[model samples]
Target: MDLAFSPAEEAFRAEARAWLQANVPNPPLPSGDTKDGFALHLEWERQLFDARYAVVSWPEEFGGRNASLWEWLIFEEEYWLAGAPQRVTQNGIFLLAPTIFEFGTAEQQQRILAKMASGEEPWCQGWSEPNAGSDLAGISSTATRDDTNGGWRLNGQKTWTTRGAFCTHLFGLFRTDPEAERHNGMTYLLVDLRQSGITVRGVERLDGDEGFAEVFFDDAFVPDVNVLGEVNKGWGVAMATTGSERGLTLRSPGRFLATATKLIELAKSLPDTATPELKDRVTQAWIDAHAYRWQTFATVTKLVEGGHTGPESSMVKVFWSELDVRLHEIALELLGPHAELIDGEFAHWMKGYQFALSGPIYAGTNEIQRNVIAERVLGLPRK
Candidate 1:
């Protein structure tokens, strides 16, 4: 298979590259964690929305350019190349919205997707509990019917809610049936962050940024309509969300490839230290990233042919996450004492390492992903 873009695809690439060159912020924008930074990111999202660049692969009626998956990949490559600020609404746009698009009602689509596209309401994922991280089926968060309120009364704490503090809504799994055990009697509910009896406390990461939070729900109310799919069958429906996470929703290979390029640039700056071992590692990072990019193409092709992807997403997850950490590790090694700086051109030297280390932990830990590959993909017997 020749891995080259068609002429039309190349034309599309030109359009995307020009648009990104014209639009991406110079000196980059601030982190979305701060209030002012968030506002700017939100406006930036709106700017992309107005240009139909925010979600290019979605249907045109839902504020997209209606581009094909290949075109979407092209746009992403250009976007990352431009060093654009990360999408402020990624949790909603990537993780939650696909589930809604696949399993939600028409009314739900009209109400939610429109707002999401406009960046009027950002969303957060609420999957992990203090007790349940990788084994998401073990979450004890409860949501019982409230007849008087015509909704569910949610009560329980959800920990490690990524970007929870900046978001206006959260989508999480709640055990709707106390009697059913392990993946049974669960429901996926979308909760408004501003609701009463709910508290969100930010967790400062190793980089000293409050990017994660723990959300406490004390009889918080969510109308029945906010629940996705059948109350007790949410476990099955949630695969759509998780599948999106691992497949292509949360990231494309472009970001990793860009980082790999940055790594090479940094290595060039340290020519004295770019030994054979270091050179080999940098090349390996590039190869891994390219492998991921190709694998994504195969996955996309499978989807286009109406084929479903399953445990293999776990493989991609492990590969890319490890690749990320490895890339950052070598970057710091090249930086030497410059990596110790908390502010400067080398500021992210440490921050990137910390962030990349968390890669294996979140979005389902790499250990769990290995099990998924062994059992589901290879049909290995469980121990």
Candidate 2:
């Protein structure tokens, strides 16, 4: 793939940069403790939506430019470089939107796509249950068809649902046939969080943020219209979504590069005498950050050339997750005795460190990614 951009592409890049310069927020919101930070992010997303810059990869009919993968990469690069505020609708725009585009009916698409694009609705994932974190097939949540009710009756508890506390909708996988094989019995459904028989309670993280929550459904009814794809085929749908999550959205190298840049800046401000070892670690973190960035560009090129990401995305996930942990570890090191601090000037780094600790765990754990690489990529026998 050509690394050089065509003249037309360069012109497009110039236009994007100009628009972003006029629109991108300066001193982007500190990843902080503000209760309204998420809402602030939502406002930023709406601004981008109005400008037709949000979800640049989505089809034009869905309020996107239907940009090429290269164009999408360029947009991401420029957006993050400009320090644009993070999108509050990322759960919708990044994860659910693609899934819906692939599996949803035309009517379902018409109903939800516009709302998501316009930031009129916020969506969250309901994939992880109390017993089904890493092993998604272990889901006990049931979404039984109610013949008389003309919809599926959902009754189950979903835990670790990110942004569930404030989200208006949820896309989840549930067992639709108990008697079928564990993975074969599931169905994916989109639920209205504000409807009757639904309850959401906050789950505080170690960082003291209620960024995730437990959601309960007590015979909640989801209309057949909300069912995504065919019933009892949710496992495949979920696999596809998870692949995208672990491979694309969550592992975007541009996001990690921006994060690493912040860490480097923080490291430079720390006292040199604090710890020589800390400096070395910080340098290594910078190198890893750049490595991830170039790898991401390569991945995007392959995708643009109509090649599947395959197991290489698993490698990306592993690299970024581990690098994230290392970068935060260096940050904590630079904090010295103040490492324990969770508020004030260091609060942002502290929260980031906490989030980075979870990087290896979410969107498929590092161990699982290793298993994927060994079995699928290396052709090794499963243990």
Candidate 3:
């Protein structure tokens, strides 16, 4: 397959590269997950928004350049190659925004997309609960109808929400029909975290970042207008967001490629540590990164040709998550004892390795993904 970009696409890549080179923080911003870092990252996000690079794939009316999927891929490649700051609004732009465009009403689109693009109202995913981590069908959060109040009353809790404590809004599924079980009778809700009956408590991660949170709702009120898609038929809507989460948008190949490039440099810097076995691992990881990039291009081709991702997204989730773990593991090995240092040049590898360890666990664990690929994609018998 020809991987060459068109002339127009190359021009777009140059433009994105130039902007990112000029705008990405020189000293690099802190992890956007932390409080002080979140504030700083918001400023960077606004800079991207002002430059019309925040959501390149989105429509111009919604603060984007109306770029195509190929251009979006080009922009991602440029964005990561320049070592830009992590996107603080990723949960919304990468995961939830596609769902909103596909499932949201005209008013919902206008009201939410612009602010989301500008980082005025960042969003966090609210899919996991204490009882419903990978088994999302077991979600127990309830959204009782309040016809007189013209909204729904939400109750229950969401745990392990990325940036939950810092986000202004949440998009999640709730059990709307008491009699409906499992995947049935759920409603996707757009909730404000600052409401009176809601509570958000930050959870400190292994790296000492308060990146995750537990959000609780006790009769939290969300208006009827906030219900995304048809009420009590949210399973389909939620799946759309999950597909984006697990598939193309969330973990773009550019991220892995960038890390792979860094891994190569780290290996070159430590000649003594580069054993044959380690060398093989580094070569294989680099090859895997390239393979992933090509795979993503193929997927983009299919998508551009009017194809939609279904359970095939599970294959993507498994490949990229494992690739991330492998790439970071090699980096730490290259660092040797220096990996233990929490400051200076080696710190990022340690921090990245720690975060990479969670990749297989989140995004519906590799085990579950394999099962989905088996049953849904390959048509294997479940029993």
Top-scoring candidate (TM-score) = 3
Compute the lDDT of residue 12 as modeled in candidate 1: 87
Give lDDT tens digits, candidate 3, residues 330-362.
988888889888899788888888888888899
Best of the two (1, 2) by TM-score: 1
- In candidate 1, which residue pairs clash? none
After superposing candidate 1, which stretches have Cα over 4 Å from the reference?
Answer: 244-250
In model 1, where is the ten-residue run with the lowest total lDDT?
241-250
> How well is each residue in 29-135 modelled by candidate 1, as lDDT tens digits?
87776667788999999989998899888888889877877888888888887888888788888888889888899988988986897799899899999999988
User: Candidate 3 — number of clashing residue pairs?
Assistant: 0
Better of 2 and 3 by lDDT: 3
RMSD of each candidate relative to the true structure: 1.7, 2.4, 1.5
User: TM-scores for all candidates?
Assistant: 0.96, 0.92, 0.97
Best by lDDT: 3
Q: Give the range where candidate 2 is weakest over 10 consecutive residues by summed lDDT.
A: 242-251
Give candidate 3's TM-score.
Answer: 0.97
